[model samples]
Target: MRRVQVRKTHKLFIGGAFPRSESGRTLVVEGANVARASRKDLRDAVRIARQAGAGWSGATAYNRGQVLYRLAEMMEARRGALAAACRGKDEVDRAIDRVVWYAGWADKLAQVIGSANAVAGPYFNFTVPEPTGVVGIVAPAEPALLGLVSRLAPPLVGGNTVVVIASDAHPIAAVELAECVATADVPPGVVNILTGLRGELAPWLAGHMDVAGLDLAGADGDAAELERLGAENVKRIVRGKADEQSPYEIAAFLELKTVWHPVGF
Candidate 1:
């Protein structure tokens, strides 16, 4: 007798658990059935991300760095699986390295980007960076693992919870990466991934009022429309190559808060 292989049913990662789409729909992509996320699913993700934002942002930068480093460790341990999902080992290596690189920046970004303003009066003023709240990311279509990790790492390291829309053409790697995030000691709802058509879900995410930032690095549709909708809430929009790396990427999702205090003699 031959053993039958059981195919995995990929679902949405929300609130630290995998769940089927609220609309109960699925689509075939690359010969596999993935959940077809709906507007409702997008709403659910935003709600959870909003709920998770405070605790994640309030967490000490040192602790955030530790969590990000743990994510890289988990990704390193699962490199074989990630490579398979991504269809190459080199991309997996880059994805892991990207995570590690961002991990190191988690605690150092404040010092690099923030500064104390020298006031001539008896007042002390300083600027500090804070998480910009929930961010919505549209992961790129090619080089799934690398693109997804590139978009995900910066915001997370900056202490922002996210609701990400995975690559429509290559979603298997995103689902696999979600599993990595689950075991990486990341808190619930901190990093949610929804797998479906970008055209179907990007609109809801861009227009969502609760989402503080939007990353359209992988967007395949009308850029003007998404930007216009995102403007309704004045969401911080980031458009660029998905695999691009820089400290400015992290700054895109952070808010610089300035404080002033009286300096006594």
Candidate 2:
């Protein structure tokens, strides 16, 4: 038997600093060293996400669209690395396409998913999609690259920042994706990704009073429980349906507001 030569190290991504997990723990995955994310890391991700704040949500739609489009371009350029990191060709292709797909939606979702209505009393009403802000996402374990991209893109395209817990057993692709995200011109703190055990961190994100929304598609066995905990804040929750694909686009992630004025003299 022969062995392949490779550099071995895994780090936690917190507040934009790539550092060793605070707990000083590491785990092995497919002959590679991976950091074991700690509670502190989880909270730090949330903090960074919140700090990015309204600037992200407040960024003009055009700027956000540009960033999303940039990400798609980066994904296309690095398609091979990401696909290899995830361990599958189809997964990589799907992940790249998914990024482009979502990028194209950033400017169009408002139009495709919105509506204009006539009010009953001489008022005009319209509804538009908006990000929920500071979302906590649980990346799925299988189909590594595409799954992670799927869970992340929609919320981000909607102008929300995300604190994601990558699949503990298969976090490599996520970290690689983070590199792409950083180069994509995506503002720092827009997507804070952590690699750790969901059972250990999902509860913290689910019940974190500060987060605006929760996406538990990857929580697997704990999806229902996380949804229950999220009820405390009435945080918007998305239960990933196994049969359905990731990166779901729905109206629930949007906020609708109506405006009224006198159109006639």
Quote each prediction's TM-score: 0.97, 0.90
Residue-level lDDT tens digits of model 1 in 1-265: 9999987889999999999999999999878899999999999999999999989999999899999999989999998888988868999999999998999998898899999999889899999999999999999888889999999999999999999999889999999899999999999999999999889999999999999999998875567799999999899998857778999999999999999999896
Give lDDT: candidate 2, residue 228.
86
Q: Per-residue CA lDDT of candidate 2, range 1-265, in tens?
A: 7898676366666655677778888778755677878888888888889888678878877788788878878877887777768767777877777777776667777677777877777666777777777899888887788778877887888888889888877788888788788888888888888876779989989998878888787877788888889999999998653224433453446665555665655
For each of the candidates, the C-alpha root-mean-square deviation to the true structure, in angstroms, is: 1.1, 2.7
Candidate 2: 10-residue stretch with minimal lDDT: 241-250
Residue 176 lDDT (model 2): 79
- Which model scores highest in lDDT? 1
lDDT assessment of candidate 1: 0.92
TM-score of 2: 0.90
